[model samples]
Target: MLSLLIRGRFPSPAVADVGAGTGLLTRELAARGFAGTAIEPNDVMREEGIRRSDLNFPFRWLNGSGEATGLADQSADWLLMGNAFHWTDIENSLQEFRRVLRPDGFFTPIWVMLDTDRDATVQSVDRLLADAIPSFSRHSDVVMKFINSLSTGTSDFSNHRVFLDSHHSEVMSKERYLNMWRSRNDLQSALNPREWEAVIKKIDELLVEEKVVLKLRTYAWIFEPEEIPH
Candidate 1:
């Protein structure tokens, strides 16, 4: 996935990872030989990201957000919103991104989620979520919105899309799986304290395996603003 997004596309890129929670994506970019600053707003999350990363890597975690990045104008080669767009005011964030990006820069937004269409465990969990929480909604809709935002008057960008069917999976213990949900902002936001606990408990009971392999599909789009008349 990184190869497709980076190979022959950028030369020693300067990336601004907006909303870089725990700096996971920033670390990935650093591992790929890309260097830049990771902007995060939440003090706790930023500190957590700083703790998760060190100076050895090619990037540094900073205090910022997509709306007000505190970065010099036109400084980034790429502005990445990896799962960060969901929390942003789309229009304002885009304008800020454009401000930070060079005229030739790219805006890459990546959305990744469980492949419920292909994985029964994830499907079961979704079903459970819907059944347990009356307000629960399919996560796939967010993926669609991520894709559709491009055509919905967001910007005059030449969009590049990753394959919808492209997916990746990870094998983890059931404990790790449950732990993942325990930390997810989406689930926590959607489910109240008791309700979320019940859902997690149900999932815990549902999974019989010590380890589970989950497949995740990624919806990625690369956006380049069109040149305007001088």
Candidate 2:
């Protein structure tokens, strides 16, 4: 999605992956021939990324937060946050993004959300989670509200124009899909040991019994700084 959007916009763009957990998106950009810089605050995740990285085309890794990237002014052509924007102080992060990005640079926040309404299996899983964790719906609602703010340009991005786009129904196998849910921080933190075990067991049973496959939706909220009149 990002590659397609930047196809004709910039030639060999310098990309910054802020809050880059395990450098997944950073490596993807590097593999696509972009000059990439991954800024992560967590030492463990950063080290793990380095350990797993292909040394042939190494990208720079820095200890930094979204609110203070520690990058040179106007150095990046694109700044991206993959499933990490909601964890940031949005106002400060946007200001820092503007400071580091070139005048023509773009800022994008991407998220992959399960399309529960369209998939019966996902809807069932959602209900199961809700029943298992009382605060699950509240936590999800907060995140969704933040996402909506970004999509509608209501998050105090006064100097930027925001465009929303989504690619729906990206398929994945049941095992891979369950792993994705298991990896979520909210689920990990919210569930106690017994509850977590029960939830996972139920999920496994449902997936196997129903032969479930996940259909996820990818959402991108693209922010472009508005040009000042000469």
Best by the lDDT measure: 1
Cα lDDT computed for each candidate against the true fold: 0.78, 0.76
lDDT of 2 by residue, 131-206 (tens): 8877776355667777777545465533344455554665567777678678876786887778787888898888
Minimal lDDT window, size 10, model 1: 156-165
Q: Pick the candidate with the highest TM-score.
A: 2
Superposed model 2: Cα runs more than 4 Å off: 157-164, 170-173, 181-195, 209-212, 227-230
TM-score of each: 0.81, 0.83
Alpha carbon RMSD to native, model 2: 3.4
